[model samples]
Target: MDMEQSRQKRSFAPRALPHEEYFAPGHRGCQGCGPALAFRHILKALGPNTVVAEATGCGEIISSPYPQSSWRVPWIHTAFENTAATAAGIEVAYKVLMRKGRIPEERINVVAMAGDGGTGDIGLQALSGALERGHDFIYVCYDNEAYMNTGMQRSGLTPFGAFTTTSPAGKVSKGQSTWKKDVPAIAAAHHIPYVATACISYMSDLYRKILRAAEARGPAYLHVLAPCPTGWRYPSEKTIEIGRMAVRSGVFNLYEIVDGKKRLTVKVRERLPVSEYIKAQGRFRHLTDEDIAYIQRRVYEEYEALLAEAAQI
Candidate 1:
């Protein structure tokens, strides 16, 4: 094969196919909801021996209505701000149950699932405590960049220029003027065993991270970039495509922090301009050329900084 063809083939790694579906279909998730896909990947990776603790968010709401649930495994519903605490309790209880001979000693992974609102904003304390206490569980944050389940309100993880109901763009101000909070960095700060960022477009990258989190973990964290159609003001069918663009445009850099080392998982050798990503969504419509240029510069700077930091380690 030609060098160019080989390099092109290397751009995307083939998906590591899953064996079983822990999340059954026929739920209320909007078409192309990225978190729904993330949940499926997480379930596919964790398997039947997993216990999920979910916060009151889109995933729990859409997947589990009164008399029905999408989860095939044991699932516990927790408050929006207490999923990590609930998962920590489950971990401790599982140990106690094992000691009493009620359950096998083999580990049954407990995963705390939440949205960006629950993770970076309300549930930060619970997550911090769980990680600091060394809970043997994975905390999954399916961040759509807003409080989408509630009312598309802004959250701490929202990017600098994204529009939301609360942080709406106007003549006086741009939407969400602050930087996106680095949740994985916060998890890494706790000196956890594993911390990673994953997106739906890269299923294999996400699956490996999920499996690794489930298989071997001490306060592992997976921050997933879930694109929301309603909140993001994009077509439902473009979810996966937009996710791919986000990564390719360097809006979201996929990486993992393991044992104090940072590694970039997927690299777009020649990144697409950030405009190619923002132009598709109405959320960024208010951004002027100067605004976009500023954001583009910031994005590339951060991407380069990440590369330099990874290289040093």
Candidate 2:
């Protein structure tokens, strides 16, 4: 056999795959949508005994269309700003049913899923309420940084200097000027049982976190950085690549908080310039050199603060 042929054969070796299914094929997600990939991985970790309460966002629209659905498990499409509230109610109902011998405790795991705009912006109040009440459920935010379902509008989680339809660049200013919200930290502040940040590019890491969160006793939150090719103006194939670059550039990090202690799970092994990630997306095309430098400084500052918090544990 030739050397090239042997190399190709080695690359195609079989590997262990996750044994689970939730989001099925034939959905309406955009090509290479990171959130779609995330949903698949998370459900694999969660297994079949799960019920999802989704908000009125991309996940709901893409997964559940009239006359057909992509979600195999029991799922509910709630209002835009009430996913967390609805999930909390589901958790309460499950406990009540279990106590009354009407439902088996091992038969279902309740989860709430929403986009960044829904969780970080519109539904934040309900999320806070659920955490404070100590509900036994998992809330997953597939954060693409903006409201992509509504024509790429700016959300509170959107990063500085990124162009959205609402925060369009003009003569007076570049794109969105405000920094992205620190959602994981906010979730940690609630002193929930578990809180973590994940990315679609790191499938194993994301899956492990979801599994851990599912087994916890009290409320848990998982914030996933799901890239959007259509909204970010990048090629469909670049979803995973850009998701990895976001973490490597320090713009995003993988970490968890348990019992009020912060822990950094994945560090930037070989740091890359933020521009490499930004320039690849059309949203940041109008950013000047000064703007890029400002973003870099912010990333470093945020990372240092995270390190300090994690060290205290």
Candidate 3:
């Protein structure tokens, strides 16, 4: 084997495969779908007694089909705007059942999962309500940055200057001009027990975050950067690589907010230009040199701000 391959083999830590599969393989998702992988890792950490409340998006459709379903756990598909509400209800039900000795308190963990559009936009209010109410559950946003299931449309979480169906680049416009919403920061503002941002590229870190979130006493939110190959217009095999590039370019930082304190979990060893990350995906193909420069500036500024926040902690 080559030196690089030898080094990789030495550094690799095999993950303990979970015997209970929450998501079966029969359902359809695009090749190299990050959300599918995210679910698998999440289930590995959460185990079999967990119940999932999924919103209307790629996750729901891909896991449920007529008489057949991919989810091995108890799953509920709710409206696009009500994932948090549904999860809150399930949590309340679990508490009541446990109190009445109708169900074992340790038997289940409730989790709410949604895509960026569903969590960052449509379900934001419900999520905020659940957190403010101190619901005992975990809310996970598998963010691919846009509404991937709905034809790659722009959502509030779509990054600045990225092209989507709703924010197409043209002679008069230059893709999405606004910045991506800081959903984890917003969740932190709610003063919940825990909030963290993770990416699928770091499987071990992501798994640990999910496990922590599940064990927390009150409401917890995990915002995961799950790449969508089809939506980003990238080759299926490049999904993990693209996700890694996003973090290394400062476009996405992996961090955790515990009890209102910010902490940086993964630091980029060698930062690359934002254009290098954008160029890998066809969604940003229409961007001009000026646009790429603007994005790079914004990414650096955001990374610096995160560093400052971490410093304050």
Candidate 4:
């Protein structure tokens, strides 16, 4: 076989993603909802022995509605700001039960799920406490860049130049006046055993990260960028495409921090111009050339800084 042929074959090798479905179909999620995809892969990685505490957000509203639920595992509905606290309590309770011979001592992957608003904004205090107290659970933040469940309101995790109900672009100001909050960095600040960033567009990477997070001895955080077609004003079919564009354009970089050391999971050797990502979404349609250029520059600086930082360890 030729060297080129061999390289191509290796590049296209199939991934061994679990076929078991934990997130059932027929939910109310909008077409191409990235969080829905993230949940499926997350559960696949964690397997059946998992308990999820979901915040009152898009995932919660869609997956659970009164008499019906899409989750096949033990799921708890939590308030927007107390998801992590709930998960922490569950983890502690499980330990106590095992100690008292009330429940089996088998490992149970405790997961706290929330949207960006719930994680970076309203739930920050509760999440911080859970992490600081060294809870043995996984916290997954499905960041679609806004309070999408309530109303496409602006969130701290929303990138600059993206329009939303609260941070709408107008003649007076550009959308999202500030840069996106670095939630992964904040999670790492707690010196947790594991912290990582993932995206639905990259399922294999996300799956591997979840597996690692589940195995962490204490306080693992996974921040996943779930592009929202409804909020971003893009076609539902373009969800995966846009997510890939975001990663390739350096709008989001996939990485993991293990025990205070950082490393990139998906390296962007030749980054696509940020315009490729921005121009595709209506939220960024109003951005002028100068605004895009500024954002592009910031993306470059941040990407480079991360590369350098990750290289140190």
Instruction: Name the best candidate (by TM-score).
Output: 4
Q: What's the lDDT for candidate 2?
A: 0.87
Q: Please list the C-alpha lDDT of all candidates, in the order they appear.
A: 0.88, 0.87, 0.88, 0.91
Per-model TM-score versus the true fold: 0.94, 0.94, 0.94, 0.95
lDDT of 4: 0.91
lDDT winner: 4
Q: Evaluate residue 102 in candidate 2 and report its C-alpha lDDT on the 0 to 100 scale.
A: 90
Model 2 spans with C-alpha error above 4 angstroms: 1-16
Model 1: per-residue Cα lDDT over 47-117, one tens digit each: 67889999998999999998998988899996889999999999999999999999889868899999998
Q: Which stretches of candidate 4 lie above 4 Å from their native place?
A: 1-15
| TM-score of decoy 3 | 0.94
How high a TM-score does candidate 4 get? 0.95
Estimate, for each residue in 229-251, the C-alpha lDDT of model 3 and write its tens digit. 99898999998999999999999
Candidate 2 residue 259 Cα shift, in angstroms, is 1.1
The 10-residue segment with the lowest total lDDT in model 3:
3-12
Better of 1 and 4 by TM-score: 4
